[model samples]
Target: MEKQGQRCSGLVLVPCPFQGHINPMLQLGAILHSKGFSITIAHSQFNSPNPSNHPNFTFLPIQDGQTDHDATSTDFISLITALNVNLVFPLQESLAQMIKQEEKKERITCVIYDAIMYKAEEAANHLKLQTIVLVTNSAATRLTHFTYPQLQAEGYIPPKDSMLRDLVPGLHPFRFKDLTILNFPNLEALLQLIATTIKIRTSSAIICNTVDCLEQPFLAQLKKQYQVPIFSMGPFHKIAPPSSSSLLKEDTSCITWLDKQAPKSVIYVSIGSAASIDGRELIETAWGLANSKPHFLWVIRPGSVRGLGWRELLPECFKKAVEERGCIVEWAPQKEVLAHVAVGGFWSHCGWNSILESICEGVPMICQPCFGDQRLNARYVSHVWKVGLELDNELERGEIERAIRRLMASKECEEVRQRATDLKVKVEHSIREGGSSYNSLDDLVNHILSI
Candidate 1:
């Protein structure tokens, strides 16, 4: 590691332009900046982060050839494929200009890019610059990327409905239906993306946004497969100083509402930025929260509910039912919401970031995964970690109500709450002076400096 007061190297970070992917990469940038590295954020123009929020770092915008409509489009695979093809040359040109301008004041060290933004790695490689890959998902999810080909070879990719309940042969605890592969619509395109992402190019090290205690087995498997150093130093929101990286404006009024509620009495519901629900499911969710007998804070992101532009389409009856007990917002400051004392349970989509935040805060979850790694994450949360319950069946008001009550109020779930609390304690320890994440972070910084 660089000496405490020494000038550290300048590092450029290229984040995938999505809420989930952008948050951790920026948080990572914050962490490195605190460690004395000069930070440059080279991001795509579409859904670009507000530079004002991170004024300390230099922001470099690369033309991604995406319009506002493209950014708002729900077709994830096509968007990703287009971004990969379009960003390569512009990113390379940006990096080239940066090197020329900053060569004298602060030598550019390496480019650290989100794994999904493989083109960033390509651009940096063309410039003969060192690079590091940041895996923003769980180690378990990353492991599936390696095993997908094998699963396909065994004819399990488009799994039979009969086999859905069975556990995968090598990847234990993951059922056929729980595979990330089953969630995407275009199998060939997703598989191609995965193949390209998993290939090792010029990266000197790999960094994961996961805790070692929760994913030791998967981390061990990954270490055996890759030649570069692997670092598990995360729950990045906790490691980095607090800052707003939200693409959508967050309503802080929810925090005030949470304050008025009784301790451990609220259920926080947010399905994440990308996932969408049908009108019927949204209606069920509204009624469920209304009848669940707990104070609830729900995020109904604009355009997240199909056929409904926002939350306005909900029936007046459901609105009246929840009028007194529920608070709904377009988006919430989730970290703040999860950390609140009134948030006893989370009804989440099991996005890795949300899972880590919930674990860090000692809040039990009601796992309702939507797609991709979320399915696997929900499985682990409810089964492997034993800190949450899953909603496996289709959305129904009664089932939703029961799930919420079981997680937030039932005596039977005290054990789950206790386990969540224990994990929270462990997460706290992992960031302390002598802990796993702390040591891993030191190793990562040293590795970056060595490059």
Candidate 2:
């Protein structure tokens, strides 16, 4: 155990570059730092986190050979493939250099990396340093990756429309349609990426950003599948002191607007950073919010709507409605927005981070999952957790209005709100002293030291 007033060991954290992935990795860094670990962040050049925000930690940028154009132009599979291949040598060299420099000082203990950055594990293994995999998504989502091969062999990969409504063989609460097999242009590449990421390799442990109460079943299954010690120490944002981790600038004015709204009267809407919509879907969404009775704060991320500038394609009637009851920004401080007393519901992409944030704040959701694990997360939120409603159909004004009403204004809303609040309380207990997450974090620290 780390002694009081003595720095224990140095850790190098490698985060995947996306906003959702970056937040938890950095928050984990913050938590370890508070526990007396010297922190070093080794990140890809693409979407590098700003060092100014975390002055205490050292930042090492690995050359990924990806320009801004490549990040924008390439498909998801291509980008990931490029990253996995391009980063291996550069990262190895960087770690080797760090090992040489820190030989006499606080020795580098282990490389804790995002699950997608498998190259980090290889690099650390070459140097005979310990490694840990940090899974940012829910345990249920990780289970899907572990079972992908079996799912494919069972003819569930290219899911038949006939089996869409049926539950997966062993994965309860997840229908065939709810699987994370996103419609990528290169299916083989995506499959390979999933296969590669699921391998435990030489890592010493797996750290998940989830609470035991939420996905205890799936976590248990994962424990049986992997030989390494699995730590469910999570809700990292709550465990660590808050910092600015957003790559996009957040519009703080929405919080001021939220202050004027009645308690639990506003519904916050954001589809997260990666998902994009066409002009038609955007129009439908605009009218849907306009028709719904609750005041709304919507984040229209720049370039998220295809073939149109931000809000330029919003119908005139919708614009008029915004003057009365809506506020739209390019991006929002989502955690802050969800935590505000006035936010009654969230219309989200059902990204794992978004779902956890909403649950943490006792805010229910209107789930509109776009791709990948989002559909699975949405299914769990609406069906398993009973804290949110899912919008599983095409975007239409009336449907959207009704979904919002169901989540915010209808009679069932209170039940869902209470459930969300109840879950929030459970999550709070999980992070308090002697709670599951707290103890898991302690165990994680000891495990790292043991290595």
Candidate 3:
């Protein structure tokens, strides 16, 4: 064993078993590793990390107690329930063993876990480890979750299907209907989990993947509610080194396709990893893409369509119409695609990572948020930031066509383009030396060392 002074303390990161969650957590691990911390990733077996990809970090897979059948389920609520129950014991045992063996050298210092994976914090507390909660989405998203109790008390949730006119406090310009939860099997259970997680997380340092300039008001609100040190270190992917943590096999062929397109002429379309569009909606979207007639690169990942075979859903005429102008792939190298010169607008699900990436690339957007924090994200994209336009819930071919046209060719698109570009520069600067995100990273590192 190396001497205590010579050995770097270890940090265990517990990310929720999803692409979005895993990417940021791995990025954080890479960031911390660069800052002289020994990185150990304790993850669920549901979506296990390839240890080969990140050789520097030790990967610990805790049996999530999920059978092959349950593991294959797309029902996120059930999966997370199983994880919350099954992860506690294996993680406890793993942490206990690591602490026992590594205390003399490279001692385990802290467990910084995903906000959703609060069970890891419980395990860490049982082992007397310093814990921090890593909020993987925008601060605005967390702000909404934190304010759920108030919304529920005011009967603002379980919103009506009608276009809501009433506004939720702090979530202005967004109607009550926009606050609906997605894929949650039990609403009460989800609420309880959020409340409990927020309570537990408040006791420690909270790290968010958002910059101060992006969500200053929300961050300020969070500070007012909780006394813990809130570190807004983000565009985490920008600050951290480049690494491939994507669960899906990314198709880099889109890059070559983009090289042939005219500058600021292509629309990059991705609905995110987990969202499943209805068969009718898929057809509508296809027609919309065809009607818009812009050079487009669309990612139609397997399972994105609800039906068993979605390839044949689009009409032959629609397919033929887009054949000359569109490139369809299974998945995309999103960051590189967004940064490409040909990508002028993004038709996105408004996932926080996607939002940041789009902002980083100065690409305006047509927001088609599906669920969870995405609705709120869309609100901010369209209303708060004025970088995107949100689509209605019902996916109509005309609406889709209009949105693409508006974003790609409308005169008003210039203003949104300017705003997106401005934010891109600001976001880039924030990750540079002495900027808000840079300073926050330093403060977070020092806090972990102190603990």
Residue-level lDDT for 345 in candidate 2: 96
Give RMSD to native, each candidate. 1.6, 1.5, 2.1
lDDT of 3 by residue, 177-210 (tens): 6674643567887787777667754336988999
Candidate 1: RMSD over Cα atoms?
A: 1.6
Q: Which of the two, 1 or 3, has more TM-score?
A: 1
Q: Report lDDT per candidate.
A: 0.90, 0.91, 0.86
Best by lDDT: 2
TM-score for each predicted model, relative to the true structure:
0.97, 0.97, 0.96
Instruction: Report the lDDT tens digits of candidate 2 across residue range 1-451.
Output: 4566644599999999999999999999999999888999999999999999999899999999998888887488778778878998899999899877874448899999999998889888899999999999999989878777887887778777788889988888898888888565677778898899988988989999999999999999999999999999989999999898999999999999999999999999999989999999998898898888789999999989999785579868778767869898999999999999999999999999999999999999999999989999999999999999999899999999999999998789999999999999999999999999999999999999887
Global lDDT of model 1: 0.90
Better of 2 and 3 by lDDT: 2
lDDT winner between 1 and 2, please give it. 2
lDDT of candidate 1 over 221-248, digit per residue (tens): 9998899999999989999999999999
Ranking by lDDT: 2, 1, 3
Stretches off by above 4 angstroms in model 2 are 1-8
**Per-residue lDDT value at 275 in model 2:** 93
